[model samples]
Target chain A: MSKHLLTIIDYGMGNLHSVAKALEHVAPNFQVEITADKARIAAADHVILPGVGAIRDCMAEIRAQGVDTLVRDVLASGTPFLGICVGMQALMHSSDENGGVAGLNTFPGRVHCFPKDALDVHDLPMKVPHMGWNNVYQQAEHPLWQGIESGERFYFVHSYYVEPQPAYTIGTCHYGPEFAAMVGRDNLFATQFHPEKSHTAGLQLLKNFTDWNGRL
Target chain B: MPLAKRIIPCLDVDRGRVVKGVNFLNIRDAGDPVEVAKRYNEQGADEITMLDITATHEGRGTMIETVRAIAGQVFIPLTVGGGIRTVADIRAMLNAGADKIGINSAAISNPAFVREASERFGAQCIVVAIDAKRVDDHWEIFTHGGRKATGINAVEWAIRMQAYGAGELLLTSMDRDGAKSGFDLALTRAISDAVSIPVIASGGVGTLEHLAEGVNLGHADAVLAASIFHFGEFTIADAKRHMASRNIEMRR
Candidate 1:
C-alpha cells in the first residue's frame, strides 16, 4: 500500500489537532501533518483546510502564512482538496461574520449569517451558531460521498452558512433557510460541518478523500 | 430530515477515571473514561461530555491528559467541564481535543468569563452547565457539585447565560439526580423555552421513555444520562432506538 501525505492546513485558527487525529484514525496509510508551510502543503497528495473561531482571525492567519494563495494554487492543480467550516467559508468572496469580512474569493459567493428569525423545522427559533448535528442532503453524486448515504447527519458549529453559486452546491441543509452543506467542483470539496467531529460518516468521507485520485 | 436531538453520555471523571454517584457523593468506579467514551462513540452517541469531577487546580493536568486520551480514541465531539474556570482552561481542553468547553461554577462566579470565553473561542464552543434544584416553586442554581446553593434562579440564570453568549446549556436537576425519576421536564422546558440556544437535559434519566421525554416533552435538544448508561442498564444505541420509536428525531 502506498502512503499518502495528508497535510491539514493549519492557519493557527482552525481545529488542527482533532482533524489531524481524526485523519490519522480513519486513513492509517495516510501520513498526516499539521503545517502552515506553503511548500509542504503544495507537495502533499491530499489537502484538508480546517478552521474554527472567527473568519476575520482565520483570514488574517491564512494570509499571514500565505495559505490562501497556496489554496488557490492547489485548486488550480486539480488536486484532491477538502475544506471544513470557516475553511469552506473562506473559499467564498466574503462573509457577514465579524461585520463583513473579505474571503479568498476562490468560489464566487457570499457567506450570510443565519437569520435571527430563522427557526428549525419545529418552528422554534434556532440558535445563531447552529451548533451540534444536522442533516446534509446530497445535491449531486460525487466520488467523496461514495460510501456515504444521502442526508447523513454531520456535526456543525457555525453562525454563518455559505450561499455558494447554484452550480457548485453538492449538498444542502436547513436551519433558518436551506443552505449548501457540502460543495464540490472537480478535485475540490468542502463542507459546512466538521467531519472530524461527525463520527462514522465523517471518517468515511476522510477515507474517500484519501482514496480519491483527483478525478471527477 | 431536520437536526436530530442529541443523546450524550456524560462521564463524570476524576483524575482519568469514570465515576458515578448521587448528588456528587458515594462515588463508584465505572471504568476507564477513555474506554467508556470509546464505547459510547461506537454505540452511536451523538456526543460525549467529560465533567472533570476533580476539576481542581492540581488535577487539571491529569484531566487534560484524560481528555487527550479520549479524543485520541473516540471520534465524536467531547465536552470537558468541571473546574474549567478560565479562557486558558478552555484553550487547554480544546487543545486537548474537546469540541466544546463546559463551564458551571466558574461562570456563575465571574459571569463575565462566559462572555470572555465566548468572545474569544466563539459561542459555539462554550457550554454553560447549570445544576438547578427546585426550591420553593422555583429552580435555584447550585455550585460546587450541587453542594452549595447559590440561590440563583434556574430559569432566570438560563436567560442570563444565554445573554452572556453561551451557545448551549446543560441543565441538570439536582432533585432528580441519580433518582431514575426522569428529567425535570418543567425545568427543562422552562429553560429550553426561555432561551433560543439549545438546552441539554441531564440527570435522572432511567428509562428509554425518559430519554424520549427529554425531547418530546422537556423540549431539550439533547439528553445526558449517567447511572442508566454507566451501570449497563441501557446502551446509547438502545436509548436512540427507544427515542426513535417514540417518534423523536434521532440520528440512527
Candidate 2:
C-alpha cells in the first residue's frame, strides 16, 4: 500500500509541531512533513494549514512565503485540506484584527472579535479568546466529522471568530455569541478549534480526516 | 452548551522526574513525567500541567526533553510552568509541543516582561501563574514556590496581569496548598471576578466535592491538583463525575 503524503504548511507562526505530531500519531501509515517548500506542499495528497497568534502576522508570512497563492491553488485542485484556528480565520474575505486585513478569500466571510464585554447566557462576563473546551454543534455532515457526535467539545483559543456564509458552515459553537466553529466547501474543511489538543474526540477527527477521500 | 470547566492534573518535574510535595515541602517521587501525562490523558484529564522545578541550568535541558517526550505521546493540551523566564524559554517550550507557558516569579519581578512576552508571542499562550498566601485581611502574592512573599495583593496582581495581556491566570493558594482541605473559595472568586480572563484555581483540592466547589462556588474556570492525582487517591473521571453531579459542565 502506498503511504499517503500529508504536508503541514510551516510559515514560522505559532507551534505547528504539535499539529504535525498529532497527525503523525493518528495516521501512522501516512508521511507527515512540515515544510515551507511550495512544491512539497502542492504535491502532497493531503495538506494542512495550522496557525496561531495574530492573523496579521500569519497572513503576512503566508503571503511573503507565497503560500497564500499556493493554498488557493491546492484548494482549487480538489486536494483534501484542513485549516485550524487562525488558519481557518485566514480563509475568510477579511478580518478585523490589526485594524483590518484581507484574507485569502477562499470563502466569502468576515472575521470579527468577541466583544470584550461579551456576556454569557448566565449573565457572567465571557472571557475573550474563549480559551478552553466548548461544545461544537454539527451544522452539516462531512467526512471530517465522521464518528464525532454533534455537540462534542473541542479545544478553542482565540478572540476573533469566522463568520462564513451559512452554506459553508459545518459546525457552530456558542461563547458570547454563536460563531462558526467549522467550515467546509467542496474538498476543503476548517476548524476554529485545535483538534490536536482536544484529547479523544480530537484524535478521532484527525483519524477520520486521514481516511477521508474528499467526499461528503 | 457552555464551555466546560477544565480539570488539570499538575506534575512537578525535578530533573526530568515527576515529584509531588507535601505542604510545599517533603518532596516525593511519583513517576516519569511523560508516562504520568499519558495516563492523565487516557483517563480524560481536560489538560495536563507540568511544573519544572528543576533549579539548575543543566536540569533545564532535561525539562525540555521531558516536554518533548510527553508532547509526542500525549495528544492533549500540555502546560509547562516553573522557571519560564524569557521569550526564548517560552518559545523553546512551545516549540517542544507545550500548549501554554506559565510564568510565576518572572511576572512579579518585572511586570513588563509579561507585556513583552505577550506581544512577542500572542496572549493565548502566555499564562501568568500567581502564587498567593493569605495575610491578615487579604491574600499576598508569593514567588519561589511560595517560599517568599512579594507583599503584593492577589486580586490587584490578577488584574494587572490581565491588563498586561495574560490570556489566563493560574492562581495557586499558598495557604491551602497541600492541606487537602479545599480551594480558597474567597480568594478564587475575588480574582476570577476581578479579571475577565479565565482563571485556574490551584492548591488544596482534596475531595471530589472540592473540585466541584472550585468552579461552582469559587467561580474558577478550571481546577488544578497535584497530590490527590499523583498519589492515586482519585482519578480524573471521579473528579469530572463529581463536578458533573453538581451541574458543572465537563468535557467527556
Please tell me which predicted candidate would have the highest DockQ against the true structure: 2
Q: Taking the tens digit of each residue's C-alpha lDDT, what string does model 1 give over B6-74? A: 999999988778999887789999999888988888889999999988777989999989889889878
Worst 10 residues of 1 chain A by lDDT: A120-129
How big is the RMSD of model 2? 1.5
Model 1 misplaced stretches (Cα beyond 4 Å) = A1-3
Task: Please list the C-alpha lDDT of all candidates, in the order they appear.
Answer: 0.87, 0.89
lDDT of 2 at A152: 91
lDDT of 1 by residue, A53-157 (tens): 789888888888888789989998887999999889999989998899999887887899888876764567876668778888888889989899888899988
| TM-score of predicted chain B versus true chain B for each candidate | 0.98, 0.98
Best by lDDT: 2
In model 2, which regions exceed 4 Å deviation?
Answer: none
lDDT string, candidate 2, B1-252, tens digits:
788889999999898888988777999999999889988998899889999876567887889899899999898889988888888889899989898899988898899999998887788999999999999989999877788877899999999999998999999998899898999999998998888899999999889999988988898999999888988889899888889999988887
